[model samples]
Target: MGDNVVVSNMELERLLSMKGGKGEASYANNSQAQAIHAKSMLHLLKEALDGVELHAPNIPFVVVDLGCSCGTNTINVVDVMVEHIIKRYEALGCNPPEFSAFFTDLPSNDFNTLFQLLPPMANYGNSMEECLAANNHRCYFAAGVPGSFYRRLFPARSVDIFHSAFSLHWLSQVPESVEDKRSDAYNKGRVFTHGASEITTNAYKKQFQRDLAGFLNSRSIEMKSKGTMFLVCLGRTSVDPTDQGGAGLLFGTHFQDAWDDLVQEGLISNEKRDDFNIPVYAPSLQDFKEVVEADGSFSINKLEVFKGGSPLVVNQPDDASEVGRALANSCRSVAGVLVDAHIGDKLSEELFLRVEKRAANQGKELLEKLQFFHIVASLSFVL
Candidate 1:
């Protein structure tokens, strides 16, 4: 286990409370596509499980969905997993073994939103009930165990399969070197660039390596031999050390742009920039492979990228003109801590307005240029 970074529960609660309802709305609105992604993950997990069964036939299975945000999407994943389990059991003509399902995320995730969405087994119709009756394997849901993936959060040899989607790219902490250095070279009047000094970039990468190793080591302890883990996350395609379009470039530059804009407009003080780093880290494929292979716990079974297009714009009515307001709102929750702590309430709004105006003037076409790689990788380890 590692010492988890301490974030005040009260502060996190305030941030979540501010965006809880809106985040729930976003999840509800995006349920369909999210379901599709979850099902795809299930398909990949099942394939891995099939290979595992060739060696260990009688062991029960435990599947965990990490960073399962509040909504039907979580249930959709459970549904798909249960359905697959039933199909597999029937084909084998063997009684299904006990199973445990875990849902995990940041302590600040909208768990209340999740609780409200739990499925009523009685209402799940006949087929699911028959499967449940035959198997006698109960479903369990839990939350708020671990924050950083850098630490062990479960018992050793306990998990059989782990699944996380749209998560795990979050860095444990901000790099110390970039803590307070604000320059137009990095941040320009609310329009930020991801250009970090070489030192800062290296520092961030080292932090990522440390966190990645810890994540895999912890998972190795809990995962049964030959257990499977599937992770789907946002990553960058470019591997170029000099390219500003890399994963580091995207975050550092964008943050700088936003910070600079805010500073020029007197929305934020330069001193606050040190406290304003986004908590997320988008790793490129090469970096991801380097970290995982170094851990020596699991081997890759499959890796692929999806959603090569720009940042997904939700709730925008116009197709050609992106909804800058909606985009800002969507970004606010994930990166809300930055605005609340640094720019404060009044200036954050002013800064967003300026950015939105610029986005509109640019015809929001540039927004369409922003691409994200949805990398899906499956891994399995020998017990």
Candidate 2:
């Protein structure tokens, strides 16, 4: 802005949320990438848990899952983390400490559906006791905590290990300048800063920096000294900002192209298109490290970045129609709600279908343009 002034847009989609509930529609498209990370996450969990030491011995071993949507992926993560922590206690000839896990997300998340998926063993309070009585080695307790992770959610040094995945790329809200008609950064016919001018991109960049700094500051407060955190999420594979390949998924140009067609059809107003910017930032690995090192609250234990390949690319469909359908469903699953709010459901559906056709036609071309960065960072809090 005129003075590096950054404004907030509360109308954001409240995190890169998946569909609510236990149904496949919630995030079936994400299953492949998530499964790939899950296997790797277990090894990270082993390292983090084995090396962890309770600051005050015998206190409840606390864990928090940031952005745990619907408990599908979270249940597995929580179960594995709890089991490993217990194994550490057993190795030391100590009785299993009371374990508590909190799954946090935005207040609007469908926690009811998430709870429905939990077995009686994960019910709060005496549930872990019952599991313990039955000789379940991983006696653990679970609950939901709903809020924006950009702010403080727990007391100082209250958490032992914090975990988040596929969620951190979501900015707390859309950048305000993108919606500011008076600002040169106004993206007159786009929905993100991806292909916009330098001003527009700068706006998104500032917003990301502000939100991430806040997130790290809050976590440093909640995490105890020597506590470890495991984070896995999407990022940029290179310093090149204009990697608008079809594979960019959330950050690609095709998304705006699909929306532009609707504007031509007079279904969506130019003003609305300019006003709606997706609250996401595909940051480079250096971007992440810079923020962490500046905060000085955590030491980087390990960091790795992988190229995220689309299932659409890997599994070539028989025809464009089939490809269109698959890509459309995938887009709808992640972004349907936001589209519905801005342009109404009817238009959003039509728009995504058109996007599908576009993706189908783009074919291997879009696949080649796929540019996504998957980051796994293991951090240790330095009190």
How many pairs of residues collide in each model?
20, 1
Highest-scoring model, lDDT: 2
What local lDDT does model 1 show for residue 79? 54
In model 1, how large is the Cα lDDT of residue 282?
61
1-383 per-residue lDDT for model 2 (tens digits): 01112223554545346666544335544455565556655776678676566543458889999988774678778888887776666567666668788989888687887787666553335543355455433356778898899999999988999999878877887777777789898877777666668777777767877887898999999987788888877766657544423335643566778888877987766665666667777677777888899999988888877655653433554566666666666666666656666666577777887787887886655555554557788898888
Q: What lDDT would candidate 1 get against the real structure?
A: 0.57
Candidate 1's residue-wise lDDT over 44-74, tens digit each? 6677656554223355566787767666666
lDDT of each: 0.57, 0.71
Local error of candidate 1 at 222, Å? 0.5
Predicted candidate 2: what Cα RMSD to the true structure? 4.9
* Model 2 lDDT at residue 35: 58
Best by TM-score: 2
Candidate 1 TM-score over all chains jointly:
0.78
Relative to the true structure, candidate 2 reaches a TM of: 0.86
